[model samples]
Target: MMGVVLVAGALQHARVHAQAAGFPDFTTIVEKAEPAVVNIRTTAKVSARSGPQGQDPYEMFRHFFGPDFQPPGGRQGPQQNPRNNKPRAEPEERSVPRGVGSGFFISEDGYLLTNHHVVEGATDIFVTLTDSREFKAKVIGSDKRTDVALLKVEAKGMAFLPIGSAKLLKKGQWVMAIGSPFGLESTVTSGIVSALGRETGDYLPFIQTDVAVNPGNSGGPLLNLKGEVVGINAQIVSRSGGFMGISLAIPIEEAMSVVDQLRASGSVVRGRIGVQIGEVSKDVAQAIGLPKAEGALVGGVEPDAPADKAGVLPGDVITKFGDKPITRWSDLPRLVGETKPGTTSTLEVWRKGKPLTLKVTVAELKADKTAAVEPTPPKVVETVTTVLGMEIVPVKEDVQKKLRIKGGVQVTAVQAPASTAGVAEGDIILAVNDTDITSPTQFVKVVAGLDQARPVGLMVRTGEQTRWVAVRTEK
Candidate 1:
C-alpha cells in the first residue's frame, strides 16, 4: 500500500512539473511592454447628412414637430403641473463616437509610432497611456506604402521603448506582443517567430510569427526576449477572420528606416535601377552556363536611365547589388527601394559566361503612366515556324513606331505559330530564353542561336496595357 501511494505521488509531482515548465511567467515582460503600447482613439467629423443630396425628407418634418423640438428663439412650452411633475431636461446635440486601433510610444519627448490606417483622415486623435491618462495627438508624417506613421502628443517624459535591430532576428525566436486587442487593454501574448523576410506582396516584407494578433493589435509591438522592439504587428492570414496561428509583423528595421525618412522629409524617397527583371529559371541557368538558377535576370533596361547609362545590358544577370545578395528576382526591388537616390553602388553581374563588375548611380523611379502601343512589322528574318502557327521575325523601326517601343522586337506575322500558341500579330517580343531583345538583330540572334528547348518570355504591349506572356519553342 505504501509503494502504491509513492507511485501516485510521483506521478502527481511529474504532472505539476510539466505544467510549470509549459507556462512562462510574463509579468516583467508585460510590465516593460505595456508602457510602449498605447490605445489610439480617433474622431472624424462625418457630416451628419452626406451632403444636401442625401438628406431624408422625413427628417425635416421630424425636426419641426418632434417632442424635443425647439423654436429658434427662447420660448417655453406648456408644462404639466401635476403632483409629481418635474421639469423636462433640455435635449443635447447628438454626437457620433468612434473607437479604433493602438500604437506605441517611440520617444521621450512625446513622439508615438502607429499605422497610417489608424489615424488617417482623423480630425481628432486621442492617445491613452497604460495608466489610463489621455492626450491629444497630431500627425507628424505618414508613409502609405509602408503603412507607418509618426504622431506627436503634447506630453513629455512619457515612457518609450528602445528600438532593436530586426536584422539579427531568426526563426523560432521567442517573441512577446502587447496591445489593446478586442478592446481589452494591456493584453499580452507570447509566441515564436515563425519565419523571417516574408514578402506578403511586392511592397510589404514582414516578419511572420504565430502570435495571437487581433483587431486592436494592428500597430502594437512584437517584443523580443530581451524586451526590445523587434517588429510591429501589422497583419494576419486566416480564413475564420481571427488568429489561426498566422500573423505578420513589419520588421522594426524597415519600419524605423521609413520612420526616420518620414521624420526627416515629408515623403519617402526610393532609389531605382531602371530595369525590369525576372527570376532565373533552370533552363536559363544552363543556357547562361550558370551553376544554379539564382539571381535576377534583366528583362528590359529603360532607355537613358541609370541602368542604361551605367551599361547594364538586357542579357546581364544581377547576382548582387552593393553588399546585399540578390538570391531571387524579388529581392532587387525591395533592396533598391530602401536605398536613397544618387547613391553609387557596385553591381555583380554575370555577362556572357564571365562575372563582371559595374558601378551604377541609383536613379529616382517614376510611376509608370505611359499607354501601350501595337506591335510593328518584323525586320524579316528567315521566318521560323514553331509548333505555334505564328511567323516571327526580327523587330524593326516601323515596328518600334507602331509598338511605341524605344527598344524591343516586333511580331511580323501570325501563321500556324499564332493559331497554336494563340498569339496574334502585333505582339511585340521582349525576351527570348530569358535574354532581352532590344533590336531585330538581337532578337534573331537570341532566338535562332539558342540550343535548348525552353519557354520564352515575351512582354506584350497591346492597346493600353502590358502583360507577360510565356511561349514554348518547337519540340
Candidate 2:
C-alpha cells in the first residue's frame, strides 16, 4: 500500500511537469529581442485640411495615432488663403509628421526592413533605437507587390536580430512580437504561430499569427523563441482597425530574396508564363481520370505566349513547372516568377489521361495578356439536335472562322445536370470527354456513349473564355 502511494505521487509530479511545459516563459526572449526592434516615424509635405474657424479637422485621426498624425493627402483647397483671399497656388504645402510604424535592424551596419506601406509617400524617415539614438534613414528600395521595403541608416555596431527561415515554422509553435503598437516603443506580445503559407498576396505567401499586432506594429519583427526573426508583421485582420487575433507577417526568406534584388538594382523583376489558371475541382478531377484534385487547371492560354508555344492547351492541367510540383494554382506564379527570364524550363502537363513533357522559355512578367475571347457569331446553324436535357446546334460557319474553331456545338437551351454543371444557354460545347464535337450528329453520337455512372467532362466556351466543366447526367 505504501508502494502504491509513492507511484501515485510520482504520476502527479509528472503531470505537473507536462502542464508547466505548455506555458513558456518569454522573459528571456523579450530581453534578447527587444533591443533590435526600432520605432519608425515619417514626415511628408502635403496640402493641409483645416476648418473655417481654425478648428481641427483631423481630431479623429489624432485620437488614434496621437497628435503627431499627419494626413498624407488632405483636402488641398476650396478655402481661400488668408494672405490672398484666393485659393493658394498649388495649395498650401506644410511639412508635418506623416505616420508612425515599427521596424528592426537586420545587420550591424544599419540595414533594416519594414512594410512598403509604412514608409510609402514619406518625404522624410527617422529611425529611433532603444538607446535613444536617432538617425535619418534612406529608402534603399521598396516593392509594393510584396509589401517589403529596405531602409538603411548610417550606423555600425548596432544590435540586430538573427534571421530565421519561416519555412521551418510550424503551426502551434511559440512565437513572439516586439513592436510599437500605437507608438508604444518596444512593446512585447506573445502568441503561437497560427498558420503558415497563407495565400493572402499573389506573389508572396504570408505567415499568419495570433500576436497582438496593431497599427504601429506594421513592419516590426516577429521573433521565434531563439530570438531569431522569422517574419515581419505587416498586416492585421480587424474590423475596428485594432488587433483581433489575426495578424499576417511577411516571411523573412522571401523578404531576403527581395532585399537581395533591392540591394542590387533598387527594383524587383519577375518571370511569367502566360496561362490563366484555376483550381481543379474534385468532380473535374474524377472526370479527367486524375487520382486526386491537384495541380493547376489551364482555363485559358494566350496566343503566341510561352505556354501556348509549349503546346499548353485550355483543358490541360499543369502538374509541375520545372522540378517544382504545383500543389495549387497560386504556387505556379511564385515558381515561375522566381525563374530567370529567357531560361528554358521543363513542364509536366496532363492531357486526356496521359502525361506529356514539354519545354517552355519563361518571359518577363508584364502587362496581362489574358484578354477576353472575341464575341460569338450571332448566327446559329439551322440544324438542331435535342439531347441530354438541352437543345444543341452546330456553330455557324462565320462564327467558326472568326473564333478559329474547327467544329463545336452551340448550347441553345440547358436544364438539369447540364445547367447544374454551370452550362448555360448560348454557351458553346467543344468536346465530350476526349472527343471533339464537330457536328450535331457527331455530338448526338458522343452523348449516347457516356458512361452515366460517373461525372463527364464537357469542354465549354463562355464569352471569349474556354474551360472544362464536369457534368453528371445521372443522379
List the candidates' TM-scores in order.
0.72, 0.83
Each model's C-alpha lDDT? 0.70, 0.81
The lowest-lDDT stretch of 10 consecutive residues in candidate 1 is 55-64
Give the per-residue lDDT of model 2 (tens digit) for 1-475. 9999999999878777866877777778888777788999887765634323232333323433444555445542235467755444555666666668899998999999998888887889998988888989999999877788999999898888899989899999989998887678999998999988887545568899998887778899999888899999887766553457998888998888889888888888888889888778889888878777888888778788899899998878899999999887778887888888999999998888878899999999875454665544345547677877668888877777866677998888778788888888888888877788888899888878879888888888776577778988786
* Best candidate according to TM-score: 2
Which pairs of residues clash in candidate 2, taking residues 3 or more apart in a chain or in different chains?
373-464
Reference-based lDDT, residue 117, model 2: 81
Q: Which digits, one per residue and each the tens of the lDDT, describe model 1 over residues 32-79?
A: 768878988766554433322222222211211333333234233323
**Lowest-sum lDDT 10-residue window in model 2:** 51-60
**How far off is residue 251 in model 1, in Å?**
0.4
lDDT of 2: 0.81
On a 0 to 1 TM-score scale, where does candidate 1 land against the true structure?
0.72
